[model samples]
Target: MPEFIPLISRQTIQNRVREIGKQISRDYQGKDLILTGILKGAFMFMADLTRQIDMDHDIDFIGASSYEGTHSTGQIVFTKQPDLEYRNRDILLVEDIVDTGNTLTKIMEFIQLLNPNSVAVCTLIDKHERRKKAIPVKYACFSLEKGFIVGYGLDYDEKYRNKPEIYDLKL
Candidate 1:
């Protein structure tokens, strides 16, 4: 097992989520917006953010996978597809973190084909340093160095999902 190093504390994450919610609310004011959360990893963040939004919005979930063990498979697998018709609707794709951009890139392509009025990306953690493609992340809580992070919806080998604080896997 890899040793874990403490990263973002639970309180800090909560504060950041509040700020992100404020930003989203301001940006999408008076607009009919739909939030589509990337499942498994993004569920926690999506739930907290949606509650804090204070605006009229709908929520849905989609499941996508990339990481296997400690590395990304470089391929995305969609387990559950979004159920709503996205035509002319403003869509926000929420993720737990943006790393490598492979998963998000593929997901964005899929979303675009649905013919939404507009689509944007929002992530709780932005691993910008690790991005290979120029995937635009509209709303991000924090930018972290390339590392294995867990908690706040991120996971480690399917463990640590319930941890409130984020941690890094010591290699």
Candidate 2:
């Protein structure tokens, strides 16, 4: 087990998510929007963000795997392929966190083949220092410079994801 330190509270996360949702609502108003969440981690965030957004939009999930334990293997494998027709639709990839960004980059490469009208990213936690690729993260709720995080749908070996608040996980 990892040592857990309280980081972002549940209330704080909700408030920020609400703010992002409002901005997204304004930005994509009168446009075809699809909220495609990167699964497992982003599931909780996607559900909460969906309620916060005051607009009609579609919800979907995509899965890509890169991490084995705490470290990323640098190779992305799609666990779940995108099922929606993205052609001419604005697709927003929602995430729980962005680390090296290799996963999103690979996912984007695949989605581009679908010929979506526009594509963007939204994340609950943004780790800019670890970014290895240029990701279009349009809406980010929180930014963390370092540390492995857990809770609020983030996990370590698939544990601690049920916690409502975010925590710094020290191995």
Candidate 3:
């Protein structure tokens, strides 16, 4: 079994998420905003953030993968696409983490093809230490210099996502 060390507590995460949601609500108040979460890592964050956002918005999900275990494969493969009609609407991609920017970059390319008015990114964790591409993350709940984390929708080889708080996974 892998040892899990406490990283960010659940209460701390919730407070930051609420703050981000409030900011997003203010920035997108008079526009048609769509929160498109990058699944399955983003599901938990998206759900909580949505409730904190006090404005009318739509929710959608896009599925892609770039990791085999703790390391990124440097390739993005789509598993599902958002079915909502979002042409000309403002889109905010809710991501669990921004690491190498490989998968998110590929996802942005695909999203741009849909012809939205504008696009931005929000993430629960901003891990820029290993970034290969410079992807603009507009709203980040937290930033980590380095560490392999799992919890609050982050996973390790498809495990540890169910934990309510973030953890540093030690094998």
- Model 3 Cα lDDT, one tens digit per residue, 103-158: 99999999999999999999999997899999999999999999999999999988
Give the per-residue lDDT digits (tens) of candidate 1, residues 91-150: 999999998999999999999999998999999898966788888999998898778888
Pull out the clashing pairs in model 2. none
All models: lDDT?
Answer: 0.89, 0.92, 0.95
Candidate 3 backbone collisions, by pair: none
Please give each candidate's TM-score: 0.96, 0.97, 0.98
Candidate order (TM-score): 3, 2, 1
2 versus 3: better TM-score goes to: 3
Show where candidate 2 strays beyond 4 Å: none
The prediction achieving the highest TM-score against the true structure is 3
Name the candidate, 1 or 2, with the larger lDDT value: 2
* Candidate 3 Cα deviation (angstroms), residue 90: 0.4
Better of 2 and 3 by lDDT: 3
How many pairs collide in each candidate, listed in order?
A: 0, 0, 0
